[model samples]
Target: MASPQIIADTEYLPTLLKLLDRAEKTIDIMEYSFAIGSATGRLNRNSAPFEIADKLIEIKESLGKKIRIRLYIEGYRETASRNMVTAEYLKEHGIEVVYGATHAKGFCIDNKFLLFGSTNLTQQSILKNHETNLLLNDKKAIAGFNKYFEFHWKGGGHGGVILPPPMIADGVFKDVLVDMIDRAEKSLNFSIYFFHISEIEKAFIRAHKRKVKITGLIHHHDAFALSYVRRTRGTAERMNDAGIKDLHYGPGTLFTHSKFLVMDNKEVMLGTGNWLHEDVEVHPQLYIHLKDPTLATNLTKHLQKTLRTVKRHRKEYTDSISI
Candidate 1:
């Protein structure tokens, strides 16, 4: 069993490519968001979106029946245009494309290797977003993740039992987060994309009242940036006003798309979904929690590093990262 590897930001693309290159039997991609060309933001000819898509096509064309490549994408109307294009393009190249209201982002290769977390398969996500992903080959973790994916893939298993720890789904997201916040004794470090969830905000306030040190990094937004940032700022700023003044906005150049919480440097809840709302039942969502001190410390250090970058840069962080 190989230890889990933590991959972040620009490093995600190369690591993903390497994994796909090495995959022999299967490549299962369960992504929440995906787009290419103009939709992925400004990019030169050498774009991650194209590179990854081409790799999938090449694998299918070269290996043929020996390789089974399947891609699951979320089909929200906002991204329907580009996503439909991508889905049709991949289908033309011999890849199985399925669409649903997916909010899970993960990759399973040969039933052995797994890459799961906040990063999306997009140009902006690859080139600009400050994303965090975990790579693992452990059979236990792989089995659990596969079951989680299958449950959602099979229409919630016709109401089968949700898998055990490490894989959280739907309403369980809040329960895990609130429990962690309630248990915190020292600190809560957050780096989230959307963050208007009131109950989670209240939970943080309660934790702060308990003298738990709180620090956060939210992507700053103004009138632009697709109303997502604009809508989420109320709760984020409310948290800042409620005595958690350390909620600093991240660099405008990068979308802080990671959803993670490090509690007292002892545990981490990191995954794809944002803190946009408490109504987890609104979307089929998934997250993973780990109680490893080492992982927690590593992520805490990552947040501290991001805070340093946030302080040094100033290009009117109010501008949209979509540019």
Candidate 2:
């Protein structure tokens, strides 16, 4: 396997399962909307989480106390209920699971492989949603991620904060993202969901006005999600009016859920959480910065693929969710 590989779109679940099957000693996972087989109580044998649970069990037969899987959902309503049931099922299988506002998403397997990104552990995130995740097996990346996973795992009930190790414990993910955006030297290619965070938007505008080539996709403004139009509409108008015309939104509602920024096609910052101000203050978000050109290039390709499905204006974005 390559040291750094970009796993995007529908490639996430299969890659995850392959890693689980190959686990030699340890497997640690932290997901926001968790689900697994024998937990849905609907005999969901075909769900992505089902296959994930099945694979974990297959490995657990050999490495009992060594494999650790932790999933804490930050979702609401049905998602919360689903996470509880899944957590119980995993516990019965000797895997530790809990619930909280743990919005981080990643997988660290056997100290060699680490996958972190904007996708959750639910069926929709794995099998359907257009997500961005990076897989790293390089020594430094793997070591850092191992520290990152242990940092969260040790947090126990609260699912830890998203700062990762060696970073200041009091730091927040929004600052990290804003700082990265503020320092943009050349360009940014992004595919993000929920654009309600004004500070990040302001930093983005600053970069754009400085002649940074900013382009990316957003979830269509007309989705059925709560206040969906309001969130995306303001963002779209602000960017468009600022002369950032390379923006596109749509490919339906679900496909644009990627939250990632590739800086100059050299570094990638990706993981869970929307850019909503209220959520940023309360939720445990994960945003990692890696200076890997190969990963950034792959993420850019992922963002550009949807340009064919998105429209530039508000009146044309086809809503995937019916009102």
Top TM-score: which candidate number?
1
Cα RMSD, each candidate = 3.5, 4.1
lDDT of 2 at 317: 41
The per-residue C-alpha lDDT of model 1 at residue 251 equals 67
lDDT string, candidate 2, 3-43, tens digits: 36778778988888887788877777767777654334554
**Of the candidates shown, which would achieve the greatest lDDT relative to the real structure?**
1
Which ten residues in a row are the worst by lDDT in model 1?
314-323
Please, what are the lDDT tens digits per residue for candidate 1 over residues 66-182? 998988777764665677667777899899887776777889999989999888878889888888888887676677778877766665621244757777766578778989998
Candidate 2 C-alpha error for residue 296, in Å: 2.4
> Where is model 1 more than 4 Å wrong at Cα?
1-3, 38-45, 157-161, 223-227, 315-323
| Per-model TM-score versus the true fold | 0.90, 0.83
Candidate 2 collision pairs: 117-271
| RMSD in angstroms between candidate 1 and the native structure over all alpha carbons | 3.5
